[model samples]
Target: MATKEIRSWAYDELIRSPFALPQGMLGRLAGRLMLWLNDPGELVTLIGKADSVLEVGCGPGGLLRNIQAKRVCGIDPSPDMLRQAARHNRGRDVELRLGTASDTGCPDGGFDVVVSVNNVAMWPDLEAGIHELRRVTRPRGRLLIAWHSATGRSPIARKNALPEEKLARIDHALGEPTRRYELKNLTVLEKHCQR
Candidate 1:
């Protein structure tokens, strides 16, 4: 299937909602809401000054703004989200682009750290997305995948938190996680190095 068709199928079968793939007027509105709902300070601290960072499914670039990287780039499938992200990170050196997890238009081994938050479950092909993300990460680099936490304070987090089985699937795809822990409203899987 083409990317667009896959996205449409994924929207119905995997995501079942626009909350993951924000687009159009409603998507722009969703981007604004995401700016207020998600906070990236703790994630930034964990990232801790990488030379380059890439955020997959960056949405409105909330985390891109706070990342302490010398070079920062973010990609989302939605042009509307990219527009919002560009506006959100305006006057900053962040690069906002239209791309997806399986086909990020970045050079090989280009990023010190690659992260995806709240959108992994929506990826049309889990293993393919993981493979592409790893391809972009340098040797001994890190891949951080996070999702809403079941124990989070926000109801959205609680509702969206993946089941243990689903989390286990992600862990298997990424190999063993260096650490798996909850940070505020997110449950994070940190994989150190490409194995």
Candidate 2:
């Protein structure tokens, strides 16, 4: 199978269905590993006291748990992942919902910032997803999208890395990023909403 096809299959079979992702235990373990691998606190710098924040494809709500904001919302396609996130953030003021990156089911201009970490590769329609994120963000609000870097030379990193073409498309769609940097094994891109 082609690389794109494999990625599509992996996303459909594993990411979209968190319960069946190498079985439940392994899936949970992977989510925990992602939490450890990516520092959710790194996102706070870009947020900078934003009153409202939204995270798309927030698997297990790991990043959402770390963000300090007046209102925080997380959305993911997998009900199993949402259940896990709810359990993890039981006492936190987080709104977890079942939704996709391309269609978040949020109001237009609803949030001060929108973030998606390690989630872009799984977006079935990457362009539409970017537009959806822009739609939900208020003008001049920040948007941060990040993923594990292929430069990490780890199997997981290589598997999760966004294709070069996809990355270019995202950069073009967002215009010029205000900041692009690497944090440990992750690559981040930040931009302000112009619409």
The most accurate candidate by TM-score is: 1
lDDT of each: 0.85, 0.75
Question: Which tens-of-lDDT digit does each residue in 136-177 have in candidate 2?
Answer: 999999888887877754677676777676677778877775
Ten residues in sequence with the least summed lDDT for candidate 2: 1-10
Clashes of 2: 0
TM-score of each: 0.91, 0.81
Residue 128, model 1: lDDT of: 93
> Which stretch of 10 consecutive residues in model 1 shows the poorest summed lDDT?
1-10
Q: Provide the lDDT at 104 for model 1.
A: 99
